[model samples]
Target: MTDNQGAWTLGCYGNPDIRTPNINQMAAEGIRFTHALSSNPVCSPTRATFLTGLIPSQHGVHSFLDPKYMMGPEAYNTLQEFTSLGEVLHAAGYTCGLSGKWHLGANMTPSEGFTTWTTKPDGSTQEFYDQKVIENGQMRVEAGYTTDFWTRKGIEFIQACKERPFFLFLAYNGPYSLGKLMLNEARNRHAAFYADKPLHSFPRDAMHPWQHDNKAFHNTDAARRRMASEVSGVDDGVGEILTALKANGLDDNTLVVYASDQGWMGGQNGMWGMGDHFRPIGAHELMMQIPFIFRQPGAIPPGQTCDALVSNYDFMPSVLAHLGLGDKMPQQPKSPGRDFSPALRGQPLAGWDNTVFYEMETTRAIRTERWKYVARIPSGPTELYDMQADPQERFNLFGQPGTEETTTDLSKELEAFFDEYADPKYDIWHGGGSKAKRHAP
Candidate 1:
């Protein structure tokens, strides 16, 4: 979840058929959001939204921005501008710690409220690599698997602040291997487990034509296997963190959250990765829908599921509400996301709108309880699908007869949503650099 590295291939939610036990166990014990999504489809934008509880338009981080954008005058001042969730928690008398990928700004130090911090440099491999920690304005490097290292740092923070409440953001970069070593391991495992069936056969209910393209994966059965293995590895890491929390006696009071930055395509739509929306071999559920689970024992009932639509943008506000500091937090002027803590507790969310808005560069989508509207900007060719009927989003019903009223209504909703929530300046700036300019009408 740290980097925009291998999001698509790792099955950010879960390959139900592939059966990741760790993820499955978590789903069984906690709530699983089937309609959760990131505010943006890429790395930096999504991270920014989660940290600040604002939309990308409000944050002016429509895409990945490097140090130049972070520091330069014309580039956009990301640092020293937006308030982070860490800062909010720190303000409310909670010690904060962050471990894992910090792609928001180049510097690893807590830029917000992390009393303790450890992070890997951007573009690093997903292996257990050396980490650079920033403590009291000082930097130090240590060696370990990235996931394990983050968990260790988090446990240390919990021990150090046993009396005082704390907030730990343990992000991981797993199941997203760039090289073939991990991929081969996954493939071998799959071959051994599912050797009787053809590895690349399309799912029976596959809605997208691209899902059947064997040539897209070409020679990547090993890659698929590796992806599955890495996901299992991440699940193991999550289990370890959960065990540590319970062992430390913090599980009862502490709120634990598990989610991915975004979904990955992973050869499900004839594509191996994400961030290629222009060519868009796949942006179906496999590439966008993410898995979100929160466990706050006693506070949030065990084994509860809420279908209320949510996204990363709601993360900060939700956390602030959980800490009883929602009143003190500054109102996010441009964020449409509301706190979902009540809904998570199995209480009916009165007036709760079940719509999640999503955008990635020129691509924009609005998912309601039953319908989905997706548009690729600059060309204005929109896609409309009834999720209840076709969750895969294969059939485009724009300009079709008898559905004109539905299309008009949804398009109007999307337009108003964009007008009020979307940032035109960021769109104009970032959309020009995008490879695809076609807009969904």
Candidate 2:
């Protein structure tokens, strides 16, 4: 995200439905993990995991910050509790810079590992055209779309930092939440996208923000088209960045990590809005499974696909190991995410557990090779799906007789996984009690 940039479709994510050539090219040039999970299906928390290699429960940010603080310096200060990848890489002599979609923390000052920062402070909280950005704390509206603006700025950082190794965390806020923010408005509008079906057909009322901005989008074809356009724009930006890398001769050495903090639900699962009590959380596969692509010239074999379980939390450790700085980085005891660098290089780690655990408030899920078991705290309506048999998840085999043993086993493993990393104060499943408990301010 940065906003609601969902993986609507790309040939790589088993969706031969929509076209995303630039991203698809990256997949062809690297390894694509079929089962990459997001720690949480939201913006800030998942972004936090990228830097800490820990899920939101361990990193402290459980939900996206309130609008009053999402862009201010307070958000940055709030994230100081964890040791960031920036501090780790910056300490190792890497020039760190960030451009675009700085929703993880305070967007104003150059904090964290980035000494160079550019973002949307001058512009209102959404959109891609004629926008203003605060560059290194100074406000200025650049003459371009936001995605293009970030691509240029990222290229600038790459060209300027030729003297040293650099880590450019370029995040774009796009398909602008809901895919209907014109070329501008980029706030809650981003999450308004829905599949090209009747919104009324779903089981529940759409949790759209203000009737999807009072538009007749209501799960119309127009909404999907707008979302597709926004994704196309992001693809163009990706092309530009890869071109810039080739132009600057940094293509061979730099390791490219293409991933998303989380995914959005476009009218799937009887809900339009994402979860954590907003709708459904950790219940549908769409929200947790994100696009994970890795590209490195000779280190990782190109055009290969890996099915081992991976998640956003594992990125930090994998990146450090890939750069040969694994031993140098300090460990976060609360984080249970493992480094998949060996898997990326075509060597699966010894004793690799091919499973991933997920939670948002009281909603919990554990996904393995064939099963995806989802449960809630003190609950009813638990779901057990045979992912191998029914990828669409149309059937719930939870309480069925033949599936009882499998469901019970998954429940035990899910609890054990959370118990290992649960910090009562921050973990939504543990300290926060249940989903209903998250309704408070």
Candidate 3:
């Protein structure tokens, strides 16, 4: 369940109300992170950060695959020096297997240390397909729903490696569709349950320009229902994996992590998904703040909740620490994530920092224990919020008199972080800025 980097869209950590009884049950038994964040807002970039434990700028895959046209050949490649979590685990005598989406690169190769892999093609537009599984280094196609097939493959891999330790990455692609089949089901169910009441409505706080102009998936009850159904589907997939683990007697010994690639707006802040036409704004907690949970009954204490400021980059180190292989993992030059093993064990993390930073295409934000500071480009002003009073981020307090000192201090910290770890490749690609420009193709 290692969410990898998906934000609140998965309904696990960020959005507590999403139908995720399985994950909720896990959280009830284990800890649910209240303020964990991803280093980047986009998929490939954040995933790169997740694997390398470095920021997006440092990992160099700032945006998704740009193809060979405008950016040149190097733009299509992943970072050269950064090591992945799979590589580390494989090196430490663990059998590694990956199933489902492998957006890091469309071309499936052996560079990612996945000894066995069943991956979707790069930039795949198909929502469901018969995937090819790599068994003992041989590829073969298997048919089923994408999530179900990946779960089957993961279970098979576990059975094959039952005699030894293994790391199985079951990455699923669900609930991201813009289609209506699943949504219709949910709508019908809701209608049958509460026919008299007005259809339950979601709040529309701030609308992106596209959402304001479009009537398709933006402001429709169908869209909301569809999103809810998709979330439930993903949760169901998680439950399937959990069931398989318990059936095979691997539930207590294995460390399960559930997360998403990045957060989606889901019409909350007037956007549908992550990183489209809208300028990346760290406005809502749903975007930057993601869910992170760990479950290992004996190794990690049950019924724990940690309020530490963790990030996607922390995942690699945290897993390594849990497996007692931290010292054997590769060293990164500048990784901001710390091992939260103590917090997972229900011990007090007294000296842990309470601030987490999030950087997107042209936006940068710093979230402290109580305050959130965000700055966007193209004449957009910085935003500040008192999270304790306004958890939904309805109020912006930047430049206000009451929080001047806090803003100033956080701004300095943000600048220092960028100075140390800002990605040089991103700076070069975007002409020293992370802003997107309109140029004739």
**Whose TM-score is greatest here?**
2
Per-model TM-score versus the true fold = 0.82, 0.86, 0.84
* Per-residue alpha-carbon lDDT of candidate 2 for residues 1-441, written as tens digits (9 for 90 to 100): 335545545556755445578888998999988788886766767777787887766666666655445464444444677778898999999999888776655667877778988876521244566677888577777766677778889999999997689999988876544433542322232224423433332223344431223234445555555566566667777778888888888888888877776776666654453554243344577777777888888888889888888878788888898999988655655568788888778886788788887767667788898999988765545889999999867788988889878988999999888888877777666554321125322
Per-residue alpha-carbon lDDT of candidate 3 for residues 218-266, written as tens digits (9 for 90 to 100): 6566656555555665677677778877888888898888776666566
Considering lDDT, which of the candidate structures 1 and 2 is the better prediction for this target? 2
lDDT of 1 at 25: 64
For candidate 2, report its TM-score. 0.86
Q: What is the C-alpha lDDT of each candidate?
A: 0.62, 0.70, 0.64
What RMSD value applies to candidate 1?
Answer: 4.8
lDDT of 1 by residue, 248-310 (tens): 888788877777776656544344445434354234555555667777777777677777788
- Candidate 2 accuracy as lDDT: 0.70
* Winning model by lDDT: 2
Lowest-sum lDDT 10-residue window in model 2: 183-192
